[model samples]
Target: MNQLQSLKKITTVVADTGDIKFIQKYQPKDATTNPTLILQAINLSCYQNLIISAIKYAKLKGGNHQKKIVNASEKISVLIGSEILKYIPGKISTEVDARLSFNKEECIKKANSIIKMYEEEGINRSKILIKLAATWECIAAAKELKKNNINCNLTLLFSFAQARACAEAKVFLISPFVGRIYDWYKSKNPNEIYSVKKDPGVLSVRKIYKYYKENNYKTIIMGASFRRIEQILALAGCDYLTISPVLLKELENSLGVVDQILNNEKKYYKNNQSLSESEFRWHHNQDAMAVEKLSEGIRKFAKDQENLERILSKNF
Candidate 1:
């Protein structure tokens, strides 16, 4: 069997692209899209209809209301999410504006707004996962949203402190990026060679998995941002692994025996109960790689959102 087929026996695979073509082919249980992927897809000929429809819908009700135009952006966001949901048997994660990462109130407000938009289209709340950066404020916002039965997928997680806070907050899921962590370490040490199983990125997610399993935290750990196929194989039995189209194809074409690399039934690490805000900040600060990558990821997402707004501005 191909590795992708083998992987399904052990892990819940998720597509990490806004491109519906790939999601259709791989047929992941879940799919995730960000401003970067959506914006890129919007410009393609295949998705042009979605853009035009979103603009027309915006102009009709908006009547030049700036809020409505921005709602056009949100409208397109929901429309795309709805389209992806048709193909996804599981939940589709739609991210809130990254600019509100540090503002708990604003994050909660926007997440609710997005959820409301989805609900307006008759999409159930359970079918969606409101995504937010794993910042302290965002985690706080997610915690509050969970009370109302709204789930969340905390993105841009780098430090163990961030993961711990999400668990304590009782958030729905945490996506600890494997590729970014590996990239950070590889950049730091240019000469040393790394193995698949021993990869720093793989080890990071494994550490988080062991901690959560040992503590019996209910938050799902989805390994994401993988740079190599080896990294994905290294994390075989993780709760979920969000794979991009590029690597998804590679896995579908390659043949190998995939093992159950992670299992709560087998390994567990004793983790502390909870961390205060100060403690979270201090630990995050101490980790140089996490500090740099977390900031960089946020900046990139923010910039991509800004670019999407600029594109929407010209047409709508």
Candidate 2:
């Protein structure tokens, strides 16, 4: 079997893109889309009609251009999500506005609104996972949303505290970023201080995975934003991973054998200890790497989301 096929035996592979064509090719179990991916798709020639049709449909409903544009953007998002679900049997994760990351109530409200919109389009809630940032307020919002039977995918997770809180809340999944962690370390230390095997991103996800498994936390860890195939291979046994199509294709083309690299049987220092919020916070804070990456991830997502809104304004 190919590496992609071999990896699937141990982990659920998810395509993290708005490019439907790529998802069709890789045939991932599930798919995920962020504002940036959707915005990129909107600019592509193949998907231009999707945006145009959504805009026309919005105008037909009778509203000003701005309202029409907002409606169109939402429609495009929903359409892309629904189309992605056609190929993947598992759930599709659609993110809420990163701008609302810090507001608990607003985050909850937006998540519900997005869920409602999905429901209106005949997409069942069971097959939809709402994606949110892993801020303290967002975790609190996720707790309430879980109570309402809404599943969430906590993205932008860098610290163990964020993952711990999400797992404690019984979130459906948490996407601890991988590539961004590598970027932060590489940028700060231009010197070749780390090998691919010991890349900070790989180490960070392994720590989070070990903690989750040791504690029997049901919240699934889905490593996201990978920059290289090595990072993905290092996390072969993670519950799920959302990889970009380009990396997925590269993995498909590679010849090296892929095997399970992580599991509960592995020994870890934190294996015997349970983490509390205070301990989680202090430990994560001490890891200057995690602290810096988490902040950077949030800022990047917020900026991309703003750029998406600007794109909507121009053509809507």
Candidate 3:
């Protein structure tokens, strides 16, 4: 088997794009979409109709152009997510607005609204995962959602505290960012860039994985935002990973052996321990890398979300 096939045996591969066309080619178990990916798709000629139709439907619902656009964007996201679910038997993670990252109640309300929209379109709620930023408020929102049996995929996770909190809340999954971590390290030490194995992003995910396994946390860790194939290869045995279609295609054509690099059994034998909230918080606060990277990830996503709204306002 090729590396992609081999990796699948150990980890659940997920496509991290809004483009439904390429999903079947990669045969990922799950798919994830954010505002940026949906915005990118809407700009394409092939996807222009999806946007136009959403806009028309929104206008018919009686709103100003800006309101119509916002409604349309939400509709477009739901449509893309639903389409993706048709290809994969697993869940499709659709994100809430990053702008609401700080608002716990608003985030929870929006997440439930999105899930309801999906259910209205005949999509099973069980097959749809609501994606949220890993803010304290967002984590709290996810905790409540979990009680309602609504699965969540926590994005922008960079610190162990975030992971511990999510795991403690018994969330469905957490997406620990990989590429953004590397970006931070490279910015700080331009003179001595690290290789893929030693890349800060790779290490961050590994550390989070080890902690999760050691504690017997049931919340799945899904590594996200990879910049290279090497980063993905390094995380061969993560619970799941959301890789872009570009990388997915590359892995498909490459001829290489992939082996399971992480094992729960091994980690359990090596100083396994659980962490209380205070311990987890102290450890995360002490790690300058996680502290800086988590802040950076939140800021970047917030900016991207603003940019997306700007684009929608101008066009819609």
Candidate lDDT values, in order: 0.89, 0.83, 0.82
Instruction: Give a tens-digit lDDT track for model 2, residues 191-233.
Output: 9676767898888899888887776777899999898888899
Native-vs-model 3 lDDT?
Answer: 0.82
Backbone clash pairs for candidate 2 read none
RMSD of each: 1.7, 2.9, 2.8
Report the C-alpha displacement of residue 258, candidate 2, in angstroms: 1.2
lDDT of 3 by residue, 59-135 (tens): 77767776776677777788778777888989999988888888989998988888877887899789988989887
User: After aligning candidate 1 to the native by TM-score, how far in Å is the CA of 95 from where it should be?
Assistant: 0.8
lDDT of each residue in 95-129, candidate 1, tens digit only: 88888889999998988988988998899999999
User: What local lDDT does model 1 show for residue 66?
Assistant: 66
Q: Which stretches of candidate 3 lie over 4 Å from their true place?
A: 63-66, 266-285, 314-316
Best by TM-score: 1
Residue range with the least summed lDDT across 10 consecutive positions in model 3: 266-275
Window of ten residues with lowest summed lDDT in model 2: 266-275
Q: Select the stronger candidate by lDDT from 1 and 3.
A: 1
